[model samples]
Target: MPLPYFGLRARISLAVMLATLLATVSMAFAAYRLQADETRNRFELAARTSFESDLKQALYQIQYGPVTDPATALTAYMTREQGISWALLDFTSGGRPPDLWEGGYRVDAVVRRDDTPPVTLPEELVDYARRSYPEPVGKLDVDGYLVYFGAATDSLVLVEFYNMGGLNAELAKLRWSLAAIALVVSTAGVATALFAAKRIQRPVHAVATAARLLGEGELSTRVPVRGRDELADLAVSFNAMAGQVGHSISELQAKDRQQRRFIDDVAHDLRTPIAAMVAVVDSLDTADAEVRSRSARLLTAQTRRLARLVEDLLEMSRFDAGVADFRTEPVDLAALVTDALELSAPSADVELRVHGDVTLTGDPRRLHTVARNLLINAIGHGAEPITVTIDGSRPESVTLRVADSGPGIPDELLPLLFDRFVRGDRARQATEGSGLGLAIADQNARLHGAKIVAANDGGAVFTVTVPRGVTTTG
Candidate 1:
């Protein structure tokens, strides 16, 4: 089984913060241990020094001469050491201490007899002191604390009691300080971890947001690039990817729309020809010689229309597939527009309006094909008095504007007028157009790095913008 995945920022921040916390805890524990050991060492040294000095002084007093009372001397020495209590026993002597005077106030002391059985130190003392100290020492349990001290002699042993109260107070202060430091350190560590994680996570978050938008079909949304690092590279790559995907999808949609239009136009164009052919054949079968001759002509006319539609479809397909070629030449736009107008005069009721003279280098045949398609579409769909213009002189370029006074196209259908095999609904159901005239015109215009646009404010006007290129431009 796979382990569940966590976010990058959270995982990094948590791991770093936890490691820092653990290290701090380990250091704090080590410091506490060292401080405790130091405190114990200091107390042990003081105890050892006091025991050696005080006991030596008492023993020296006896060695010099007969000491008056050793127990009294030991107690007086211990009482001076503040909080230090001691007990001393003389294993040999059995007598009461001589009276000592403090300004006429007599102090009494008790001494154990030398012949009395000696008090045996506890076994815990023997074991602990033997392990903890090289010197002869004793630890007697007093309340809850173990008092550590040395015993000088079997006959006259001197031991000091260590007060646990002071040690406990010091340890409590240490713990409180450690706790405060840990809290401060932990807070700082967390803040630092969050700050670092945000710094690293910001770019990733932006990328994610952009991705979501892109998934929702917003191809233009892009991540804001920051540093010159991997994240910036990712943003750049993502933008490029979005552009390619958007372009491909747009192209596919356009192709699909074109295909649907092609099917509709083919069906509409075929219907009239097929219906006329049926009518003509019926007439030929039943009519006399003159009627049969007329029907044969009608049949030929419908066959020509069908043939024209098929040829247009094939030519448009060739252009779409990039197989169409241009035969380039130097062409005079002034004469070209005039000739195109004269040739279209037979079909068009509108008179061509001449404009400024222009000349260009181009393929005359393809350019003528573009002009014929435009003029034919205008005459076929529009009313009388169509206007055609030619502009550009020294640059050898041409601009043709064809306008008519017919009922203008609807604003809704104007955008799709140049698409393959698209015709007005009324025209598709009633008129006799192949619907490929404007489509072919638009394609030919694009073949020369040109474009065509339609407008119908007062009447329908089509403009074909083209450059005078000797070699067919894209």
Candidate 2:
């Protein structure tokens, strides 16, 4: 799968954090290395200086050893600085121990002193002096110290060692301070990343959510433009696009409905005249044939139904074209229901009962159509005894309900009832009809600023609710 590109906020934030972290860590490491090198250099210098001082004093005193004290000089030198340790050795032998010295700090040694039994310092310190100062042999850094003694004279060589505790402590403090600074910098970077990320992602996220809603069939949802920035401009453009899409969809649907209604209307309207002409001709040409008379009657009956279908389709077209002029006036809904009941077949008596005195601001012709179509649909598809209830005293609106006691509309047809040319029975059989009655009714109702919905309550019920006194132009 391809990776989704997160908006600039995330990208910028990530870049900043990475750059900051890398720089901080790099600087931290550099600081540590520099400090360590300096500390090491300083420690080495101090140790060498102490050793040289001790050695110089020891050599001068050793030359006059028969009368001078070299121990005091060694003690005084070691006391002046913290990082040094020292020892002294007197050798009386004519030749130095060959195996006793190797480097700055000797590893093994023995000393021979006169008048005081043999006193030996650490052999390692002595070896360090001999190897480090190979040229003179008497001046060498052993045990981190410079040594001063003579081979010809019985002399004591002083070795000095430097203390590292204070230096180590100072290095540790520097390292911790650097670490703390790095931590602070890292925290600040994270905070800055969070703030910048939100600012950049919020508007993009809004657009994304709006797009999702549109995809899910909510054409009304739109991203609100909040700024003059690019994202805001994108949102404004999106809203405009959505509006155009909605308008286009509506126009296409209206055209499709008008075309279907036109076909149904032509078929119905032509059938009536054709049947009348056929009847007149058959009566004149075949008066003696009874079968011919019966055929004529059937044709006439079908023709009348067709004419009504065609008339309904034409009316629907007028509404779709925005030319169906509506007369806004107070209509006695009770009287209209009575007229509808009279128009329906008597066998549907129980299915079409009218009740209540509901008045609405609408065109009487269109409201009557709405009532007639709803009743016809109920009676034709439902079991007899449909109950028509009118409640005009609603706090916000008036409701006219026509419910049938027949089998409730199938779940599938409920949503499409107001669609053009859809009949409940035809839908069940996967068949088609002129399919304009309910659609025409819905359009007419909406034209009068009213709304209609379909449901089932022990039967299928179509509820037409009109906002009181509200009238809409065709």
Candidate 3:
């Protein structure tokens, strides 16, 4: 079968099972070969030792004349050793001498055709024995029997053959037993591999399912952490990513809602001025001189208000599109504040305080706008004695604070203080100042790499902080 068609669990299980089978089969084959070699060596050694001992005794008896006939004594000795057959060749006269004695032992009596014996020495073995007189102790293979040869005297040779039929039968049985064992072990190994693979597959499947849900826009989907492993770490990282994605989606939705509200408010604000101008247009053409002058004044006021609102909206749009131009230069901040205060010309009843001085690199026009907005916002919403503080004590930055003595901004409005069209209250909405003042000031401050913060310390305080050597082009 193609590999990719298999699931992860099945693939893992197959791999483990194959490895186990290979190892088990290799080890079993090696062990069987080693045991077979050891058994063969042990049997050969024992047979050779017994044959040598019996040959030595027969040779001693022949040399000392214990029974007079050497051949007859050797034949009688061979009969007593079971599972061993022997043949004695007397080469005293030389040149293919007849074997004086042949096999009397029977390894398989029932399989034999006659009492003459089933095994007989081959000519090749006899020739080898005759040629190997100086080193007469050697082994030979006759059919399937293991034969050991030894020199009894200078011209007499003793050849003994051992039957290996029983050893062969035992080895065949062991081979079949090993085959059965391998089959059983392989089956068990496959089962164990499957069990282990299942344990690992569950968590992987959960992660896959969670990923699918996340792909389908379920940002809250998460995998349950099961253990302390790399998979668990992956699950944790996925959860963190999902949370970040959810938060980012929420933020985008909020911005979308805020944009809708801003458009609606802009439409409402524009309609008010347009309605007034439309009502006054007909009156100016047919009314008396006194009424015409009053209507004209009203028309001009509404036109100025409309123009201011359009300008503020355009500036805000430039800031939003990140395309506002900044023409920067070094300007004295104290002088800038003084100029803005003079331009505002607050009522004599309201006290004004100024302190400290600092020079900063920024666009004078934008900085003037920021100062004017902050001063106007303070004068319009706050009570008398508006204090403007210029703190440049630090070498790296400058601070311009506009504070007023009034019942500071409401707690709920502080967060939205810099938002466009946000007024202090319904009462403040009736005032002439456009609510875009603070929002514009905030955007301009950001353009100069500065930030404006609002807080209540005795009253509403708006602080503008510009970093040292700020680039205005940003």
Computed on alpha carbons, the lDDT of every model, listed in order, comes to 0.69, 0.67, 0.78
Q: Write down the worst ten-residue block by lDDT for model 1.
A: 104-113
Give the lDDT of residue 394 in candidate 3: 82
TM-score of each: 0.54, 0.45, 0.79
Candidate that scores best on TM-score: 3
| TM-score preference between candidates 1 and 2, better one | 1
Task: Give the number of the best model, judged by lDDT.
Answer: 3
Q: lDDT rank, highest first?
A: 3, 1, 2
- Candidate closer to the true structure by TM-score (higher is better), 2 or 3: 3
Q: Candidate 1: where are CA atoms >4 Å away? A: 1-6, 18-258, 278-287, 338-344, 347-357, 394-396, 405-413, 422-431, 456-459, 470-473
Residue pairs of candidate 1 with colliding backbone atoms: 91-114, 92-114, 93-114, 94-113, 350-385, 359-396, 360-396
What is the model-wide C-alpha lDDT for candidate 3?
0.78
Output the lDDT of residue 207, model 2: 84
Q: What lDDT score goes with residue 159 in model 2?
A: 42
TM-score of 3: 0.79
| Per-residue lDDT over 62-168 for candidate 3, one digit per residue giving the tens place of the 0 to 100 score | 77756766666666666666655666666665444554235322223222222323344455555565576434576766566776766666556677667777788
Off by over 4 Å in 2: 1-284, 351-357, 426-434
Q: In model 3, where do residues sit more than 4 Å from their true spots?
A: 1-4, 51-73, 88-129, 134-144, 150-158, 169-184, 215-218, 277-303, 322-329, 343-357, 362-366, 432-434, 447-450, 471-474
